[model samples]
Target chain A: MNVVDARQAVTRAHREEWARVVAALTRRFGDLDIAEEAAAEAFATAVERWPDDGVPPNPGAWLTTTASRRAIDRIRRENRRDDKQREAQLCYDSPPEPLGAIDDERLRLIFTCCHPALAMPTRVALTLRMVGGLTVAEIARAFLVQETAMGQRITRAKAKIKAARIPYRVPSAADLPGRVSGVLAVLFLVFNEGYLTTGPDTDPVRQDLTAEAIRLTRLVRDLLPGDGEVAGLLALMLLTEARRAARVSAGGELVTLAEQDRGAWDAALIAEGHRLVRERLAAGTAPGRYQILAAINAVHTCVRDVRDTDWSQVVALYDQLVRLDPSPVVALNRAIAVAELDGPEVALAAVDRLEPDLAGYRAYHATRADLLRRLGRSQESRAAYDSAIVLAGNTAETAYLTRRRDQLG
Target chain B: MQYLISVIHDDSTLATPDEMAAIDVFNDRLQAAGHWVFAGGLAGPDSATVIDNRGAEPLFTDGPFLESKEHLIGFWIIEAPDLDVALTLAAEGSKHCNRKVEVRPFR
Candidate 1:
């Protein structure tokens, strides 16, 4: 193989087999540091040797074997000879199962990474690194965190998992339903980080985090196909992703729903999103927060014109969502729809009540600013816009708010 | 693997009769399941003393090492294969004792 082709194959193999190699190593060696380092070394070796030797027929198995050797070598070099023989016996594990077994291994790695014992951010960082096969630098860049600090967080998390003996197994049946939501939460956070990435210097939209989140969520969905929330999450991501093209203007400012060009939205993603939403609707099961939210997005995407949108259906979905999650954020979103249906005066009352809870939330301020502007209270609206612009983290959102505030003149 | 499930409380209130009954049942279940290793409640932190001996002259303190509103009132060291089992047991223990619990792995 040519050098460039060999390098591309190595990259593809790293993406495909990193998690499997790491998961299998972790199960055998029972050490995150050892498993992660060994997998990385194996990939590095592939880069060095694949150009001359050609790619292996079964890259996953090849990577796993190389990684196991690296791990065992490290064990011997570290003078842990007492564990060497015993660990070698573990290396002679049952023959690798088909795809189903690989899925289970990935599931275990994911559940372990998303364990509730670890803090939320720790779970996100670890999941990205271990399960998503992302580098520490890449993850840190996505979240706008210092690489050193993010590295330490992942290090401490791995140590805790090892010391605490966080098992490399999925939650039991009873725990699965509740715990899957936690896993979904981490994935959703990754998706949102990509969707409306923060900071001035960073890209307003981080396709990497969003794409990774969708990829990982799809993996979870496949692993737990019967999960409604998982389906709902996937649907929600697809619907949101469908609008990605039109969400930002040519100037890189966020285009509100009312202003985005309908022509720009991806038809295929919208169709897929609509199908998932419809499947859940036909299932006759009571919807969860994500399902209801996806339904709401489906409503928004189903329409070709902003003026043709069904305000009542959107508001109804938000009402259903409020029952599931009575957070101020949901209430604030509901109020936005309320503005369209019940007019700004009524929506303003609801938005104002959420102020105590969402005082610092940029969207809350932006919503309030829009409602006040509709009521012809330009001065109050301008002030609300100011608060929103200041609090806005995403460059696109900030620019959008700035343009809106200027337009109040 | 073993987890130290520390029972935490904000007040000096001892377990009520009902709570003690529940704890007994929970402890019995843990024993039956082979998850029970050791479990006990402690007196108030006022009964504890702290001694620092790292210095040349050992210093003695009359109270707990750190005085805080919430303190460890009891604990259970339960043996389990992994954290999931340990966490579920800790949750049950917390419910039985009617107090918050924290789990930490022993090195």
Candidate 2:
């Protein structure tokens, strides 16, 4: 390759290796902002020199080493007058003795980004920014928010981390279980953003988000062996992701579960998900929220076809889920499941009970409309669909409801 | 080393007696593992006493050193290999009581 091609390759490598470099540097430096700055500087230096010198055999390791050295140099220069700076310099100049054990730097970074001290929205923004390696503009666009607003959210999250003195280290064995839930929640949120795009195109934008979430969950499961919930979460994501291919139609319309093609689902992920859930269940522990949710997904994936789905078992799982986590959303899901398993009239009753709390949620109205349509209440169903259309944030979902309304007509 | 696994939280929202008994069961487990040093729930922060030794004469206070919305409800000093192990034990303590546990190294 020519010099220009080599330089382009070097630039691409730097961008690709940025996350790994940042994670390793953060582990060494124990400061997210400094690690980020040093890693960026290392990448800039690599861009200027790597093309001329040729790419290193191990680019990521080289970037990590260079970033650590850069961080040490910057700290020494800035803290020349402070005594603690001398100690920090000595500590950095001689790196810790390399232990050949597998370090969970990326998982630690994820936990730090999803620290409970930060607000949930801020946590999502920071996780995407630091761990997912998405830019402010990308995240802002994905969430349909302003770039400045998203940028400020990340800045405030980082500031909170510093002020709270949130440890950069991974949680202890006992704390790991609780902490895992928060990390999973952040990853799931990221995946949902991409899996259900609210944009005008009416199609999912970044399937990579769902893939990344599964990857991160797998990392967590590996780091904490015998963590059933972690395994369950990974299984849950896999089972849900397995259906992604059939979630929308050729015309980019949302397809309900009963309408999706089971043949198009990723069988490998479904098999792996079922295996994990079975293993966890056999361990003789009471199921947590993740485990229960995974079990529900497992049931959904087990059917020969959507019509073969055991709606009764699904309703039972939703019952367990509501008992475990009494969220409005859970109740909403249970109502739909109940409608499928029992009668539309019973489901309509459950929907009526939920209306006081779920008046603002678009899905509640859409679900009510579906149940009403099934019960042959055409006028009520149309009114409910109209209400859902007004509250619907995503264009595709609104279109799906509109189609359902037309079908009722 | 005997480490203090301080269970800090608001006293007003303290666990019930049955919950406290459950915490004792956890403490028993820690004892069986030979890590439990001592554990007890404290009264409200208003019952605390603080001594200030900065001046010529040491000043004494009737209540806690700092006034805050969330006060240290209780503490446990346990023996463990390191901070990591101590933190794990502290986390169990927090889980049993459904509150936060701050594992501070005793000087």
Candidate 3:
């Protein structure tokens, strides 16, 4: 194969086989650090050899075998410990195993990576690296952190998992609900990070990451077909993704829902999202955070024009969500909906009560700026906009806030 | 695997009679399930002393090693297969003792 073809083949192999190879090795070796490093080494080897020898017939199998050998070698070199040595000896040259329909290995890998024992940020980084097969540099770039610090974060998390003996299997039925939500939270964070990928502290819109988040969520949804929140999260991502193109202007400023061209949204994604939301509604069970949020988004996407949007239905959904989650952020979002149904005076009263809780939050300032501007309090609105612009992380958001502040005349 | 579940309290306040009864029940359950290794309620940090012998002259200090509002009031070492089991037990332990608890695995 030529160099370009070989490189393309290697990239494809890395994307497709990285998780499987890591999962299989993790099962065999029982160490995430070892499994991750070995899989990376295997891919590096593939890069070196595939160009000369051509791609293997079963690239997944080839990568798994190569990773297994490397893992055993690592065990032999660094470990004089009897237990590890025995495991290495037993795993050496083990035949490749078949994966089940949902692939228990990958599920177990994800659950372990997103284990509740780890902090949320750590869980996101670990999930991206182990489950999404993102390199440390890519992950750091996406999140806007130093590569070394990000590497240490992953390393420390792995060490903690091993040290704490965090189980490497999916949670039992009793634990599934809580554990699934934790996994979904990590996935949502990744999706949001990608969706709003640009900010002073982040990179420009990383659609690739949003796509990865959707794919992983889809995998989880398939694995737990009966889960409402899983389906809800997938639906939420799809619906939000549908408007991504119109959400940003040609000048790279954020386009508010009122200003976005409704026709520019992806109809197919919106359709699929609505279907899932409807399905959840039919499930008859009280919805959770994601489901409620999905329902809210559905209410928005259903309208061809923002003027035709159903504000009361949106407010009702937010009321349900407020009951489920009384967080300041949720309260802020509800107030935004309240502004649509009630006037700025009523929404401002509710938002002002949240000031102590949301003093440093950027969205809080932005919302206040909008509400104050609507109330004709231009000076206060300008000050609020200034706080928001200073706190805004993305360049696009900052640009949007700056324009609003400058338009006070 | 073993975990140390340390009960934390902000004062020298000991467990109430009802709490003690609940803890006794929990201990019996742990023993029945083969999860109990050892457990005890401490005498509060007021009874603790800091001892350092590595220095040429042995050093001694009054009270706990660190002065803090919250202090470890009790601890239980339980055997389990993994963190999940240990956490469940610790969570129950916290409920029985009616105080916050921290679970740390032994190396």
Candidate 4:
């Protein structure tokens, strides 16, 4: 194969097999750091050699075998005293299961990474590195931490896992229900990191991270098909991602949701997401936070245009969301929806009530500014816009707030 | 895996009679479930002694392992398939003992 095609093949394999390869090595060597390093090295070798030698038929298996061999060598060299024990451990490993059967290795890796004993940030970082197939640099950039710090954090987390003897297995069925939230929270954070771009010039969409989160969520959904919340989370992501393209304009400026070109949204994604939400709702299980959010987005996508949207239904979903989530951000969103259903005065009152809770949140000020401007309180609107501009991290958001403040003049 | 469940209690207080009865029932449950290995209550920290042998000769001292108002008044060593099982048992142990329990798996 040509170099271009070879590179694309390698990238695809990397996305599909990184977790599997690393997991295999981890199971064999019983060391996460070594497992990750060996898997990465195999991938690097593939990038260099695949152009000359054609891509293997079973790339995942090839990577896993190569990584396992490297791990065996490393273990032998590092612990000569325990060589016999290591060898005995490898000798009894179960043969690879058929390709069609469920691969529990990736699930085990996810559970181990998101173990509650580890700190929340450490869980997110470790999950991104191992399960998401993201480089330390990519993860560091995503989280806005120094590369070395992120690297150290990952190293420390791995050491903690080994030191604390966190088992490399999926939780038992009884424990599974409680642990799902932690895993879902990490996946959502990864998606949000991709969805919420920090700078104007950076690509509005980090498709790799978003796609990775979706893929992982799909795996989780398959593992827990009976779970309505898992389906709801996948639907929520798809629906939010469907509007990603429309969230920006031709010149890299922020497009308010009310003014976004709905036609630009992905129709296929909307359809799939709407279907999932309906199926989950029809399950008639008690709705979760994600299901509630997905139902809200489903309402937004159902209408032909923003003005035709059902504001009361949107407000009602937000109300449900606030009861379940009860966070300042949800309150801010509910107030914005209230503006469309009720009047600016009522929305303004709602926004003011959240000031104590959402004092540092940029969206709170931005939403208040919009409500104030609608109420003909130009001076207060300008002041609110100034706070939003100061708090805004992205150039596009700051520019949008500046323009709104200027318009109030 | 073997796990150590340490029941932490203030030295100023002792277990009530009802708590002692609950703990007896809990211990029997652990024994019946095949999770009990060994367990014991410790003397107060003030009556403890420590010995250090890293030096050229042994050094004897009259204090607990570490100085603190709350100390491990009792502990249980239980075998379990995994941390979840150990934690569950530890929760019941704490409820019976009427004190906070700290659980750590043996490395």
Top candidate, metric TM-score: 1
DockQ of 4: 0.32
Question: How accurate locally is residue A304 in candidate 1, as Cα lDDT from 0 to 100?
Answer: 94
**What is the C-alpha lDDT profile of model 2 across A31-104, one tens digit per residue?**
67878789878877877777678878888888888889999887777777676844642353212323324366
Q: Each candidate: what lDDT?
A: 0.90, 0.78, 0.89, 0.85
The chain A TM-scores for the candidates, taken one by one, are 0.94, 0.87, 0.91, 0.92
Shift in Å, residue A381, candidate 4: 3.0
lDDT of 3 by residue, A1-409 (tens): 8988989998998777787889899888888999999999999999999999999999999999999999989887776666775564344442332333344788889999999889999999999999889999989888878999999999999999887888777777778889999999999999998888745645457798899999899878878889999999999999999999998899889899999999999999999999999999999999999999999999999999998999999999999988999999999999999999998999999999999999999999999999999999999999999998877576778888999999996
- Among the numbered candidates, top DockQ falls to 1
For each candidate, the DockQ is 0.65, 0.06, 0.60, 0.32
Please list the residue runs of candidate 2 whose C-alpha ends up more than 4 Å from where it truly belongs after superposition.
Answer: A1-20, A44-52, A80-103, A199-205, B1-107
Minimal lDDT window, size 10, model 1 chain A: A93-102
Across B1-107, the per-residue lDDT of candidate 2 in tens digits comes to 56677777865866889888889899889989999778788888888889989999999889888899888787888876544466567778888988887765554
Write candidate 1's Cα lDDT for A204-302 as tens digits.
Answer: 999999899999999888888888999999999999998999999999889998999999999999999999899999999999989999999999999
Error of model 3, residue A379, in angstroms:
2.7
Against the true structure, what is model 1's DockQ?
Answer: 0.65
lDDT of 4 by residue, A247-269 (tens): 86777667888899999999999
Among residues 3 or more apart in sequence or in different chains, the pairs in candidate 1 whose N, CA or C atoms overlap within 3 Å are none
- Sorted on DockQ, highest at the top, how do the candidates line up? 1, 3, 4, 2
